[model samples]
Target chain A: MTLSLDLSHRFQGFTLEAAFTAPPGVTALFGRSGSGKTTLVNAVAGLLRPDRLRLSVAGEVLADTTAGIWQPAHRRRIGYVFQDARLFPHLTVRQNLLYGRWFAPKSPEAAQDFDRIVALLGIGGLLQRRPGALSGGERQRVALGRAILSQPRILLMDEPLAALDEARKAEILPYLEQLRDELGLPILYVSHSMAEVARLATTVVLLEAGRVTAAGPVAVMLAQPEHAQSLGLREAGAVLQGQIAAQEEDGLTRISTEAGPLWLPRVAGEPGRPLRLRILAQDVMLALQAPQGLSALNHFESVVEAVHLGDGPGAMVRLRAGDAAVLARITARSAKAMGLRPGLRLHAVLKAVSVAQENIGRGA
Target chain B: MTLSLRVSAVATVVSLPLGIAVALALARGRFPGRQLLNGLVHLPLILPPVVTGYLLLLTFGRKGWVGQWLDQWFGLVFAFRWTGAALAAAIMAFPLMVRAIRLAIEAVDPKLEQAAATLGAGRFMVFLTVTLPLILPGILAGTILAFAKAMGEFGATITFVSNIPGQTQTLPSAIYAYMQVPGGDAQAARLVLVAIVIAMAALLLSEWISRAVARRIAGT
Candidate 1:
């Protein structure tokens, strides 16, 4: 189902104007802190009333201020997974998951089943436990299950992983990917992390100071220089569009990208599925002469588009491959050694195993 | 003594829900003249007992506007009846009950109520299930306060409802009656001891109940 949100809300000393149509997939509202990403998601969930707003989910009019139509939060059918999880502390995990089901409109046959949600989120073993007894990751998983059992047409996740540590984030990301793939429900995910946006988002909506700076599919937007500035040089990288070329022996998998065929550690998925590999700027090594790499397995010939020297001890070199651009953050010593300059011809060397499977964005 | 206890219990029970409703309104709801409503609820607590009783009598006596209407419409009487005594006692205790409940409601986390609303509960459902249960300790405290106040109510009951024997004469009224008559001083002193015991017992009972509820809800 499609979710269309066009809203303008003004708060004290801030005005939020955002408009986007998210298709059935995970659409990440990417931005920095205080960019009104949470405000936009709250508006979609009917938690915040916008002055002049028009929002509809799958053709159902949820809010249209000009038309004098506004459905309250309860009737909106948009489940929100807050950053804090917000699970009912008074109830057990099982009761919290089933809390929304009791109020769900009865049907002759429920399409979005309940038991399926329990197994999907892997909360069967934790049904009897309270939210306080569960770990951070477990609480998030249960929160997601509760939201799904509510049978929401669209799910709004606001930094669901922000409160979690890196390890906990890794633990919960797979379940989120499973939900995106299995449930077929549209999700409007809010986050400040571009890595998360690159990994999970089919569409990226970049917000800055309460406005839509850029919004489009992950691949094209990430390639733009404007989008690159949103992500800093060190974190900025190319999202290599590729398919599972082949699985090599010794547990490494080869994938083809616009730059060239690349190999990475074996990912836990079938062959022929599309994958997204994030090549960080720090990971790329530029060579004036195509040096025979001692250990690195992937190399791509590119033209250096621009070079920005840092006041510290490094330089950021932007490289353009076949259709996408890659960044290389190299020390000034190495840049001078290689005689690197803007519009210079160079070959970028990247280690095959250095690009871990965790960086790969699975198919939406 | 038993009549006084029964009168206090009846008055407490009758005014408990009204006090709770008014408390929640004062704590949560926004309306025009809210401050005025708050002051009106607190008026009896600040005013002298005789003054409150005089106001009640002026409005609820047999020839009064409300009393005449009740006599004509439903043949109900609040003038010099046991019901009238209970009303006088409830009015005297209403402020204490309302103050306790209002503080409790304010202490409850509103985010919990918002969470309930997100789970498909309407406003009334959220209040009934989430807000009310969490404030039960406060309600119990309010009940005990109102009960104690009603048991000690003397000026209001005698002034508005009259100290009629076997009808409106509660324990306090009986004690007052005995103190007025010759050779009834011993009876009046005995009733005072009964009042102290009842008040202390009510206080201890409320404390026990409040602790039990707090432990259960707070999981301690």
Candidate 2:
């Protein structure tokens, strides 16, 4: 399934003109606030009418202004998970989850059994509770499950995690990854956090001042020097898809990455499960020589692919570790001292504990 | 006092739905003459109570346009009768009820109603289930205020339909009748106290109900 949006909307001082085709995966609309991310998603959700909108999801035309075909939000079959998780206060969790089902078209062949959704969202324990009783993370999870139960062709999430604290965000992201891999649902996720985009998105659409700055696979787009500047050079990194190999006795979990095996502080998942881990550029260090003894647990031999210089003080070095690429944010002085350039071999060391636990997820 | 209470009850029951409609229209609907409609709704409030009664009498007298049609078709009468007094009180209190309701409806988050719409509720369904329930506290408050106003309505009722004992003699009209008669001060004073107590009690009751409902609906 694919979603396409060719829309132009003008709101106050902001003018948004963006056109992109998002493939069946998690496409992160990454940008700063007031950069038209929410506006673009709202247009797709039919919450806002653009000046010109020609949008389709899975070949279904939701809006075509030229043809005068505009489907109201309910008929669009596009589920939207709002940032606030606007659950009905009067309804129980069970009732809230089924709120959209009454509007969904009859599907004799594709019935979404309610029990399955309850279990999938892990709301079985709190089915009778009201939304006010649930924590922020739990409310968001229920919101997502409610959207999914309606059986949407595509889901539009407008910063679903923005309302949660760091712990709440960590609590919900695994389920999100599970939804992405398990359901095959095309998701349009809007967020300002580059870390979230790197961890969850297969495709990233970068927006700046309401225009498309870049759009492509997450790996290639994020590796670009221009993209790094927008995402902050310190936050730039590569996302590695790995699987849980085993849990070591020393409180470290080992994962098999494309580069080889990487051991990180213990993750709470079973062996052999897929995981997506983000190695932040700042957490990685480059060594001119293969160090004899280093306390850091992760070290991979990589050849310098490109060195990108920012305005002052720092440079971003891209390296190819086996078939995978990783980034390191090193100072200009260090880059010169280490004689770092394209085609130079170096060892990249990363502290096991410095990698945020939230960035570690189970990758297929 | 009892007659006035009955008149207030009947008028409130009759005009509650109309008040809600007018309020919603003012809060959400846009039309060519919306400002004119708004002004017209408040005319009874701004006019002298006697002038409003005179207008009601002109429009709804037995020989008047609407009164004539009603009498011919349905044997309905609002001319110099208890019903005419109720109508006068309703008109006089209509603006107060509508203002409260309109403010409440405006305070409702349109996004919540939109959320309900996207949940597969039709427009009417959304209003009935979501919008109406959320604004019910306001409706209750408005009804109580209008009822209190109607109970104390004397000028419009007496002008439209003379203060006939047990017929159109509401609380205020009864008090007025007592004041005009010889040796009737005590009776009028008793009725005045009853009216004040009822108004205070109704206000308190509405406040309690609104707070309880706001808690349940908004969960704040």
TM-score of each: 0.88, 0.92
Worst 10 residues of 2 chain B by lDDT: B211-220
Give candidate 2 regions above 4 Å deviation.
A106-112, A248-251, A268-271, A352-364, B1-3, B72-74, B218-220
Backbone clash count, each prediction separately? 0, 5
lDDT (0 to 1) per candidate: 0.82, 0.84
Candidate 1 TM-score versus the reference = 0.88
What are the per-residue Cα lDDT tens digits for candidate 2 across B64-138?
899999999999899888889889988888999999999999988888776666566678877876788768888
User: What CAPRI class is candidate 2?
Assistant: acceptable
Residue-by-residue lDDT tens digits, candidate 2, A61-173: 98999899898877788888989888877677888888777778766643446776677778889888888788899999998988887878888899999999999998887
lDDT (tens digit, per residue) of candidate 1 on A88-181: 7666788888877767787654544767888888888998887767888999999898888887888899999999999999888878877887
Instruction: List interface RMSDs for the candidates, in order.
Output: 2.4, 2.7
- Per-residue error for B51 in candidate 1, Å, reads 1.0
